[model samples]
Each structure stands twice: as C-alpha cells, then as structure tokens.
Target: MDIKTAAAMHRLRLISLPEAVSFLLLLVCSVLKRTTDFDAVPVMGMVHGVLFVLYVLFWADAWNRTRWSPGRAAGYFVLSVLPTGGFFAERMLRRESEASVIAARARREGVVNA
Candidate 1:
C-alpha cells in the first residue's frame, strides 16, 4: 500500500483498541448506573462516540486510498460494532500492514516485481 493508505491503516489500528476499551467501559458504566450510584455512562458514552467517529473516518479514508472491495470494507465496518471486534480488527490490520511493508521492501530491493 502507499504511504497515505498505510498511515490511514495505522490510525485505525491505533484507535481500535482504545475504542473497544471505551465501549466495554461504557457498557460497564451503564450496568453500574442501574445497579449502584456509579454513573460514568455519559462520559464514557461521549468518549466512545468520538473514538467511533474517528474510526469511521479513518476507515473510510483507508478504504478510499486502498480501494478495498465492498465486502472487505463492510467487514471492517461490522468489526467496529462488535464488543471484541476492534481487537481482532487491530490484529488483522497489523498483519496487513506488516505484510505490505515486507512486500514493499522486497520490491524496492528488486526481489519482487512492483
């Protein structure tokens, strides 16, 4: 992938974990709000909302830059909604990024065709 695409992927990957954590925390806060005096739902809701927006923006950018197929793009979007999906998304993105880097290096060194 090109630098812009790579950067977009990196951004998405970086936000993925935090977003997931925020989502989980939000859920916990929601539960606590009902069961106890603890009520962090509003704060955590805002945090997760912002992160989720960022993730969507970055995801769109990556999709545009990489020209990913519709199915692939949809898969990523679906992952963003699931409770533990961001972790998996992050892992997948990391592997994809590493593979791209390796391929880029090989191509640069004349070990593979562009």
Candidate 2:
C-alpha cells in the first residue's frame, strides 16, 4: 500500500480499539446508572461519543483511500454501533494492514514478479 493508505489504515486501527473500549465502558456505565443508581454515565458517555466520532472520521478516511467495496465499507460503518464490534473491526483491519505492509515489502525487494 502507499503511504497515504497505510497511514489511514494505521489511524483506523489505533482509534478503533480505544473506541471499542469506550463503547463497552459506556454500555456498562449506562447499565449501572439504570440498575445501581451510579452517576458515571455522563463522563463515560462523553468519552464514548468522542471516540465514536473519531472512529467514524478515521473509517471514512480509510474507506475513501482504500476504495473498499460497498460491503466492506458498510461492515466498517456498522461495526461502530454494535457492542464489541469495534474489537472485531480492529482485528480485521490489523490483519489487512499487516498484509499490506508485507506485500509492500515484497514488492520493494522484488520478491514477486510484477
């Protein structure tokens, strides 16, 4: 992959994991507020909201640069809302980025005929 593609994917991967964590924590906090009368919901809500926005921005960047298929793009977009889906998105993207790096290295070193 080119530097721009690589950078975008890297940003997505970096933001996705934390965004997922925050989403999960938000869920927990909301549940606690409802069930246990805890007041941590607002703080966690704000954190998750910020993370979600960042995730969406990064995802859009990656989608544009990568030229992902409609299905792939939808998958990434849908992942933001599902609990634990961020982790899945991160894992999927990690694999993709790693493969891209490997391919770039191989191409640079002329390991495979172009």
Candidate 3:
C-alpha cells in the first residue's frame, strides 16, 4: 500500500477506539438522563457525532485508496455502527497495516515481487 493508503487506515484506527468509547459513554449518559439528574448526553452526543464523522471520512478515504471490495467496505461501515465494534475494527486495521508493511519490505528486499 502507498503511504496515503496506510495513513488513511491509521487515521481510522486511531479514531475507532475513541468513537467506541464515546458511544458507550453516550449510552450511559442517556440512561443517567432518564433515571437521574445527571445529563451528559448533549456533550457525549456531540463528541460521538464528530468522532463518527471523522471515522466515516477516513473509512471512505481508505476504501478509495485501497480499492477494497464492496463487502469489505460494508463490513467496516457496519462495524462503526455496532457498540464495541470499533475495537475489532481497530484490531483488524492494525493487522492489515502490519501485513502491508511486511509485504512492502519483502518486495523491497527482492523476496517478493509486486
């Protein structure tokens, strides 16, 4: 993968955890708002919204750069919506990035042909 493609994946991976956390916190805040005087939903909602947008933007960039299949792109999009799915997405991205790096190195070393 090229640097831009790798960077796009990295951006998505970095945002994934924070987005997931915000989603979970927002759910908690929603519950608190319903049951108690504590109302953090507004703040959490804004945070989650921004993170989710960033995730989507980065996902699109990665998909464009990597030319991923429709199924793979849809899987990533589905993960963004599911609670705690960002963790899995992050793990999968990390593995993919590592594999790309290894492949690049192998190609550079003449051990593999591009």
Candidate 4:
C-alpha cells in the first residue's frame, strides 16, 4: 500500500478504540440515567458520532486508495457498529499494514517483481 492508504488505515485504527470506548460509556450512561440521576449519554453520543464520521471518511479514503473488494470493505464497516469491533479492526489493520510494509520493502529491493 502507498503512504496515503497506510496513513488512512492508521488514522481509522486510531479512531476505532476511542469510538468503541465512547459507545460502551454511552451504554453505561443509558443504564445510569434509568437507575440514577447521572446522565452523560448526550456527550458520549456526540463524541461517538464525530468519531464514527471520521471512521467512515477514513474508510472511504482507504477503500478508494486501496481498491479493496466490496466484501472486504463491508467487513470494516460492520465492525464500526458492533461493540469491541474497533479493537478487532485495529488488530486486523495492524496485520495488514505489517504485511504491506514487508511487501513494499520486497518491491523496493526487487526481491519480488510488482
């Protein structure tokens, strides 16, 4: 992958964990609002919303740059909605990026023709 694609994936990976955390916190806040006086859902909601938007934007950039198959792209999108999916996404992205780095190095060294 090129630098831009790598950067986009890296950025999306960075956002995923915080978004997941916000979602979890929102869930907790929802329960608290029902059982007690504490309520922070609105704040968490906005934060998650922003992060989700950023995730989508970065996802689109990565898809366009990498030309990933629709099925692969969908998998990334699905992760955004599920709890703890961001961690999975990060792990997957890390693997992909590492592979890409190795492939890029190979290409540069002419160990494998592109």
TM-score quality measure for candidate 4: 0.93
- The Cα local distance difference test for each model comes to 0.92, 0.91, 0.93, 0.87
- Model 4 lDDT vs. the true structure? 0.87
List the candidate numbers ranked by TM-score, top first. Answer: 3, 1, 4, 2
RMSD (CA, Å), each prediction: 1.7, 1.6, 1.7, 1.8
TM-score of 1: 0.94
lDDT ranking, high to low = 3, 1, 2, 4
Give the range where candidate 3 is weakest over 10 consecutive residues by summed lDDT: 105-114
lDDT of 4 by residue, 12-83 (tens): 888888877877888888899999999888898898899889888988888888788999999999998898
Best by TM-score: 3
**Per-model TM-score on C-alpha atoms:** 0.94, 0.92, 0.96, 0.93
Supply candidate 1's per-residue lDDT for 20. 89
lDDT of 2 by residue, 1-114 (tens): 889999999999899889889988888888888899787988998999999999999999999999999999999999888888899999999999988888889888889764
Q: What ranges in model 1 sit over 4 Å off?
A: none
Candidate number of the best lDDT:
3
Identify the superior model by TM-score, candidate 2 or candidate 4. 4
lDDT of 2: 0.91
lDDT of 2 at 57: 93
